[model samples]
Target: MQILNVFLVIFLIVAAIMVERTKDLLSAVIIFTSYSLMMALLWLLLRAPDVAMTEAAIGAGITTNLFVVVISRTRRTEK
Candidate 1:
């Protein structure tokens, strides 16, 4: 579990960098989705299924949709 925690932390750090450096909104959103999935996995490992479910739904699902809608609404930002 400790080793897994270290690995997860590394993955999250990489994902965060990817999210921050991405120029395209859509790519940033996809990285965010990956971050959310990682959060869910961490929650599951910590024995918090409820939090994991909420993270998955709100972070990965609804948030992604909202990002997509906002990106669609703004045409100038598209690459």
Candidate 2:
């Protein structure tokens, strides 16, 4: 469990960095969604189910959807 926690944290960090480094806006949004999901999972592992659910719902679901919609209505590539 401890090892899994460490791995998830590492993955979360990498995902966050990827989100920032990605040249494509859509790709960055997708990575951000993934990072949010990972955060929810980490919360679950830490025994905070309520926070996990909130994170999953708001961070991964609603926010991601909003970002995708906004991105689709604007542009796909970055400068």
**For model 2, what is the alpha-carbon lDDT of residue 33?**
89
lDDT for model 1 comes to 0.89
Candidate 2 minimal-lDDT segment of 10 residues: 12-21
By summed lDDT, the worst window of 10 consecutive residues in model 1 runs over 70-79
lDDT of each: 0.89, 0.93
Segments in model 2 whose C-alpha atoms lie over 4 Å from true places:
none
Q: Write the per-residue lDDT of candidate 2 for residues 1-79, one digit (tens) a residue.
A: 9999999999988998898898999899889988999899999999999999999999999999999999989979988
Put down candidate 1 lDDT per residue, 2-50, tens digits, no spaces. Answer: 9998898899999999988878888889889999999999999999999
Candidate 1, residue 35: Cα displacement in angstroms equals 0.4
**Count of clashes in candidate 1:** 0
Report the error of model 1 at residue 38, Å.
Answer: 0.9
